[model samples]
Target: MDGLHAPASLALGIVPRKAPALDIASIPRFWFDNDPFKTRFFDALSLLFPEGEKFFIACVRDYRANITDPELQQQVKDFIYQEGQHGALHTAFNDRLKAQGVQVDRILAKQRTIMFDGFRGKLPKRYTLGQTAAAEHITAIMAHRFTHSDVFASAHPVARALFAWHAVEEIEHKAVAFDVLRTVAKGNWLIRAGSMLQVSVTFPLHVVLLMNHLLKLDGVLPNPQVWKDGRRWLLGAEGLLRPMLRDYLDYYRFGFHPNNHGNLAKIQRWREEFAEHGDARLATDRTLHG
Candidate 1:
């Protein structure tokens, strides 16, 4: 538990909870705050989750037998379950993008090719697992930002409920893959740092590429105003993602553990809501109406 410092209370149970049930048939194209930049920002991420989660699961499970800590072994099982649910739910939502005429399959296909397919068997397993650890660090940081910021506040309730619920679990079990990677790598920081370097370029590039695909589909890729809004919203003075840079950089530091940057305090209320209701819709109603 050297780097696994989250309170025992935070790890109460990492179960597979329901995704917020909303009819995907009628969710408007720009569902978050009616702004193209904001809505598409999330859509871009959603587009990645299916393939991304699958890769993450396999990466960690590859080292499952190496887990020596009883607590970590159990956490690994829960992590697999959680990532499975996230993939399944996001796959269902991607269909909505397909229904909206976005050709999500194309994006997914590209991901399969470059993101995981090309490198899995070709690269050393350690680097891939390190990539998993880095990716998990990034995911956890994003989860933290969403739960603590106004970023998702105006998203349609369906999306809001889904992300908020996902965020809590991500924070809860953020260290599972990292712990697995650390044990397997024997605390060699270079493997992890080298992988982060790879992810640092590729992750954001992939998301922006997906977002561009969506914007191009909507015939808005040429809109200067869209770029302006995106800049201000994501890169400008108070961008939701801007504040997470420090946390992101922290991943490169030696002896870094996810829980060092973790906390359930801000999202504690949502944690209780999910644990109590065990239903996405149930938690969502409390989130929206509360």
Candidate 2:
């Protein structure tokens, strides 16, 4: 509309699938590379989704009436279904974590308290959507990175499938929330940036809290090597964050838009792989193969 983002009728092509047949009951506790840090790193993120998606859906739905465009309104519906399914599957996955002695309910309770009690009732509606938009961007970038990040090279097939499915959907609809934000509260890049700042800090902080708890449970909390490797894994020269920092920083640009960071090929691969119920290993980025 402003020569910045995609058009209102962008046809996001969001396809919400029935729950994937993830055999959560049998997944190894250390599903990612058999390392506690890697496994719980994503597991902790799973803890965020159910609550996160709920908040994200609410933020978008609250402003739905303001969206007069039929295409965007339809995208919003598909977005809700897609995000809702993500939360459901993650919840199923998180519930499975309890079998591994993770105290998932307690962790979920903490997240719920923070979202429902702490912010939902208090934050202004527009800011909530802004934060949602910011978070979607962060997720879209992270989802994009996962496609190529070595962090997931040795990740179990089930775990890989979860991330891959979630990633594709995130990429497809990445613009919806931000477009909604632009529609209802146009030209609020500052708020988008502020919300990005808020989510950027809070998100990793919560993940750290979760990883700490999970590691302590595994009796790996005192392992200096885990922390060292993790810092290197995330912040090191060739680490996950290093390669992704530029994309993350793009959110601050005056004309930033998710469309500018497209990864359609990867999205198509995952969609095809999952549609046939093939092991998603083929759909993952080439990093896994190389």
Write model 1 residue lDDT over 210-237, tens digit each, in one string.
Answer: 7887888888888888878797888776
* Tens-place lDDT digits, model 2, residues 36-118: 88788888889889989999999899988888899889899999999999999898888877877888888878888887687
TM-score of 2: 0.90
TM-score of 1: 0.90
**Native-to-model Cα distance after best TM-score fit, residue 261 in candidate 1, in Å:** 1.3
Score each candidate by Cα lDDT: 0.77, 0.79
List runs of model 1 lying over 4 Å from the truth: 1-13, 18-20, 281-290
How far residue 282's Cα lies from its native spot in candidate 2, in Å, is: 6.7
Show where candidate 2 strays beyond 4 Å: 1-12, 149-151, 276-290
Give the TM-scores of the predictions, in the order they appear. 0.90, 0.90
Per-prediction tally of clashes? 0, 0
Point out the worst 10-residue segment of candidate 2 by lDDT: 1-10
